[model samples]
Target chain A: MTANARPILETERYRLRILTPADATPRYLGWLNDPQVTRYLESRHRPNGLDDIRAYITSHDGHAGFLLGIFTKTGEHVGNYSMRIDLPNAVGTLGVMIGDRDHWGRDVVLETRAAMLHYAFETLRLHKVCGACLSTNLPAIYNYRRQGWAHEGIRREQAIGDGGSRVDVVMFGMLARDWRQRREMEQEK
Target chain B: MSAAKEVLAQAFDVSITEVPDDAGMETFTPWDSLGHLKVIAAIEEKIGRDLNTEEVLAVIDLASIEKLIAGVHRV
Candidate 1:
């Protein structure tokens, strides 16, 4: 796909679309600055400014990896979903951030994840998708578990967390066949 | 308080009496993201049903929770 060619994925209450340099606003930067929001993310380890965000956004353009902005249906940009596609291996790695605390606990993560997974497996024809999270991020781990992702493994002392403490990184993976089966089961229910 | 409000109060570790009718993330002090997840889990347990994506996102406040629960039970 071209740099500007992005698929828009929609859930019941939100939309996911390609992120552009224009989205590197102060509000988006504030999400990075919020220690509470980025506590489990590597971004928290380093200070970030608008220039860094703009460069990050620019770097993804026309790349194998994709970054999409998460927006409410009413046009509120709340967070982001990034996927790194490895075409040769037919695999993708997923990452997500829900910056808007107000939208938390509302299953927005699951909704956006479902949409992205659909794109990965159905549209991109990827065989598997993987994700990783800090072990302390219970909500993210729970979200992955509920969505039928397998607990691949854990890397001990993989990264430093908030307060400079070493933390394990939990890895998760899901195959396209398994994801399709789960969707079928949900539909049957 | 309604059953949903009771669930919310319990999840937030507040008294049922303390749960305002319009309590939400914006209005409730303890309604943080983690607290919101607990509230949803409690409500799901109380109702004996898993909330779908739309129902989950629809719950924003006491009124919305009550309404969504009523709709679920109505079905």
Candidate 2:
């Protein structure tokens, strides 16, 4: 399915939509290239042109699950949350990038993540959703933890960042059963 | 309910003699990363509803916790 074909999800403050070719611009591409943003990510190559971004977006599946563009109430694009499904493995990996530095500590990620987790467990029917963050990135780890993911140990010196430097990667995961139980409790209240 | 209170106490490791308004993430020590998960699990066991991760996060406090419990029955 095309990216737009997937149903849109809206929280009280954000509207998550699918990304399109129209979003591939120098302004958006610059965020992907920023060393600070890409530091924890596996890819180091910045998009050389729109063709690269378009290829990436079009290749994604909107039906099974894919990237989302997070927007504010006023319609500004804030960040993105994407889930890649591994059906055979019965799990998905969640990745988010808040392009706007201004919204970093505002709980937007928490809300966005919560929304995605809901979608993953209820709609996707996945067994688990997992995330990995660089050990040095305490905020990300802290965010993931606060949202109910369990610390699953670290990969010692497994990440290769810019300049060929090594960094430990912390893994976190949440089971669908755990997620459902958490939702159930919230309902009881 | 006494059971709810007991679960809250066990999950947060706090007395929570009464569900206080100020009773939030900042009030208790165990009300932390691991504690949040424990509390979610506790509530699930107590109420019998399976919460999604977002639902767990949305119930950020005792009041929302109560509301969530009530909402589940309507569904």
Model 2: residue A140 alpha-carbon error in angstroms = 0.5
**How large a fraction of the reference contact set does each model reproduce?**
0.17, 0.03
Query: How close is chain B to the truth by TM-score, in each candidate?
Result: 0.85, 0.68
lDDT of 2 by residue, A81-128 (tens): 777878777688888888777776677877878788877777777789
Docking class of 1: incorrect
Q: Tell me the deviation in Å of residue B34 in model 1.
A: 2.8
lDDT of 2 by residue, B1-75 (tens): 445466677676677585455455545444654356576777787678766433554445566566566665233
Worst 10 residues of 1 chain A by lDDT: A1-10
Give per-residue lDDT, candidate 2, residue A150.
80
Q: For candidate 1, lDDT tens digit of each residue in A1-189?
A: 222358899899899999988999999999999988898887887879999998887766445788899999899999998888787888889899898878877878878899999988888888999999987676776577557788887787889877887877888999999999999988998
